[model samples]
Target: MITRRAAFCLPALLALPARAADWPLRPVRIIVPFAAGGPADGLARMLAEVFAPRLGQPVVVENRAGAGGIIGTGAAAAAADGHTLLFGSVSMTIVPHLQAQPVPYDVVRDFVPLGLVGSTPFVAVVPASSPIRDVAGLVAAAKAGPRAITAANSGNGTLSHLATELFNARTGTAIESVAYRGEGVLMPDLLNGTVALGFLTLSTVLPHIRAGRLRALAVAGPARLAGLPETPTFAEADVAGLEVDGWQALLAPRATPAASVERMAALLQEAMADPALRERIAGFGVLPASADRAAFAALFPEEFRRWGDLVRSRGIRAE
Candidate 1:
């Protein structure tokens, strides 16, 4: 009788949806919670270019920028259709905790993690003509004149700003921050010798560094990136607490069909596994990372816990 009951229960359990395939019945939208042309935007476009044809439906990228990406991300979270997905970066994890009120969306409860796309190192850069040539020199200059260094950040409470703040807190130096609408604007000023220094993604700053328009002082990562081997890692510069990476990720609305998430995740993994796609994106200094349904599901809670600690401990507030 026990064996009979077990056999009956097994069939019922196995009858439940297994997420094997048969997803994406129609067109899909990928929301990028920032302006076009940045790292997140580029990543989304690349994925769309590769995913649309394989999925037999068009994939579109929509840019919804504002309020440190809250406006756009909130829109994505509220999307009712599983066909709509969010392509976001560190801000998706950072903003909710840093805001005084609850953010527009709950990072832990409102979205499903698809997986990390990739991460790039953060570069401490200044205008090429600036007097501070390196991390040590910048620290010394800031010490001599407190809040004298004007650093440009695309937004308040962003990874770039947080990285800069972490550095300030560790080194005990004051760096007055200048907020910008976007990196496109900041890069020009950085190239023209307007801002003293700032933390920007390596992929965004790499060309300028090569062009000799901006000076890279250090890279913030676990180890120095292969392309910029000569640049010292933050640890090498003795800049404690100067460890943070810029990342991109994919997210779906909470409770999206498991089958839908699984199918998209599989296609994404296949797309990333393509050698040409990997090579082209890697040339931009961003690596490709993909995860399956179960692993991807675990990312949001972990990121929420980690970033929430940093925001609370550091008292980072949205400006």
Candidate 2:
């Protein structure tokens, strides 16, 4: 059934992969949309250090931080060449939904998720001295006087803010959500009991929790974290729909070749297998990931839709 024209085209189709695989002709840059000192920056630097030599080119980590990472993210989206990649985070899905005007690019439409890097779950915490010892007690207290129990967040429209809102919605407690400039300011107030409760990252609150300044009531992850082994998950506490695992990933421009994307994802899996790197990532209370491209494809879009639904339902807007 092979026609003369079809036979002529078969050879060209077979050669496509060879052309697509010819990428990273020069140095590759991983764009960290956040500021220079945060988790994305640190992780990207670590990845660059491990992945550069094996890639047969230099890998650079560039910080294009601003507008809560939109500036850098937009820049990466416009990069048609395979040389530029994005060190993306939970904020990507949240930002577009929270913005008043539309952001420069659509995450799902403009970029292809390369692979998952890691994830950290938000933990619900009260001051060590709080009488709210468990999830039930916290909910009961918040319900008693919704105004009395304030939930502190890093800022409006952040994952922390949305987590707080999600908890309130699920529990039927209209607890006031307070915004701090960032976790640094929120931490001092949280320890001093100026803020009643906050759903914060373990990395930001783990030391304080260990020193007995913060009481971790429940974890909003699939299971209890290794660092906080004794804390129960929200579902275990009879509270459902509070799960939120803030994830990290790498993405490339949508126009990048499929072969290049697969190769980069393979490199990520290999790097994640490194014991030293895994230890370093875990030191910050993050779980290292080695998921393949298909997994990444499934995760990112669901996250995008999930956060969008929450933002719209809650009327969450950027600060």
Candidate 3:
């Protein structure tokens, strides 16, 4: 003989199993906002390889490159299913402020930061035969006259462009900037001395520097890079308050359950802690610096504000 209260609780108890189903009911999709063969794509694929076995499901990497990561990122933010995730970079913070029209998604509201992948410092490089040997030399030449030094960037409002702008602002020099479609287009001009200097990812220019085609005068980070130990950092070179590092992180749609988010974060943290995995990521030219969900959530707001201020102050606009 069941009491009235027990009868009322039976239906709820019976539904618990269905309500508490494990996440990843199907294959998980990791969206890379940039094109394949880039740093962000590489990171996503590496993460997927580790996540597949941990989550007991397939983890697929999807490249949805367009508009400097806006299209793919917006798609990820709008995804209703928890199965889709985004592998984003610093451009996630920078792109919103760059657009003239209103952006479709909100960085602070539309998605939850799952974990931070890693970061790589940008290296300031010039042709090996160029007369500019260091940051000071570059500054002195730029201050000598208007348009004295021409710097090339991958695109308008890109990390490379902002880095050059930050250098000019901090050092009180006027280095003219030339924008190219992408790094592939900019590399030729940089190597041939058509452009005076450029800030590029360490991985992209490390070979050139080692092969005697380009000279790395300074790196953009708080400390010097291990691969370019001889090169000083921007702060070390007397240009204080000019630190920038290209970082990548994972994000999920806002509607995703907290349990799923936590599970993914735990899995990522465990994978990032593996020494063998760290060595492989380091080989790709980025430092392995993984953060759990809470840390990543705190980091996003700070970075968003910092990049927003820089973009507005420099009057940077999209092309």
Candidate 4:
């Protein structure tokens, strides 16, 4: 017999299949909350190319750069279409804590982490001519004089900035951080030997390192990079709490359907598994670290707390 409850439940059961089938009915937009030509934008475009055919729809890359990625991230959080996703970076975890103003979206509440694209290690670099050949040398220099060694970073609250702070806290050095608008501005000073040291991503500093303009002292990761085999990791250098990577991930609005998130996760897994794709990402100096939805979900909150604690303890602020 069809009871009153069964009658109402029947419609919802029928709708589930329809919702799953109708997903990706239109173009999927991946919002990159940074200026074009940066790593996040490049990654978004690459993912778009791979996701389009798999999702049976065009995956459009949108740049909504402003307020240090808040504008686009907020837009992605508010989107209910399920077709719109966010290509977020470690900044997503760090920025909210650093901002003086209230953030529009909550990392844990407003979004679901669909997948982790990968992470790239930051390198501790000095000008090619600097005598500081390794982390220990740099530390000794910093201890010689307070704020004597100027440590430059791309911006305040960035991974580079936080890493520099962590370095100071862990090693008991007072290397002052000088924040710049972007890497473009920071690199020039770094190359000119104006800044004593920098904590920058491999991609941003790789060209300089390869061109003999910058020297890599250490990599902030668990293991030494294959390309920079000679460089030791922070842990290897006996510097703990500095082993963090600048990671990117795909996230959807929290209200997005479970089926759609699962499908997106599968497509991302397939894309990351492709040898050609992995090679391409590596060419850009990013290691492919694609994880399933569950893994990413677990990783996101931990990162959020980790960065938050760092920011608060250091009193790091964003301009």
TM-score of 2: 0.93
The number of the candidate with the highest TM-score is 2
Candidate 1 Cα errors over 4 Å, as ranges = 1-18, 35-39, 63-66, 188-194, 283-285, 290-302, 309-316
In model 1, state the lDDT of residue 301: 74
In candidate 2, what are the lDDT values of residues 195-227, reduced to their tens digit? Answer: 899999888888899999999999998899888
**What TM-score, to 2 decimals, does candidate 1 have?**
0.80
Scored by lDDT, model 2 comes in at 0.88
2 versus 3: better TM-score goes to: 2
User: Whole-model Cα lDDT per candidate?
Assistant: 0.80, 0.88, 0.88, 0.87
lDDT of 4 by residue, 224-317 (tens): 9987899899989999868878888898898788888878888888889898987877777788986577888898999999889989999988
lDDT score at residue 220, model 1, on the 0-100 scale = 83
Q: Per-residue lDDT tens digits of candidate 3, residues 1-319? A: 9999999999998755322238778899999988999878888999999889877899999999998788999899899877899998888999999999978999889988988889978999999989999988998888899989999998899899999998888988889999998788999999998999998888889999999999999999999888989999988898898888788888889877777877777888888899888888887888888657788899898888988998999899888
TM-score of each: 0.80, 0.93, 0.91, 0.92
Task: Give the runs in model 3 whose Cα sits over 4 Å from its true position.
Answer: 1-21
Q: Candidate 2: which stretches are off by over 4 Å?
A: 1-21
The deviation in Å at residue 43 for candidate 4 is: 1.7
lDDT score, candidate 3: 0.88
Ranking by TM-score: 2, 4, 3, 1
| Model 1 residue 233 CA deviation in Å | 0.7
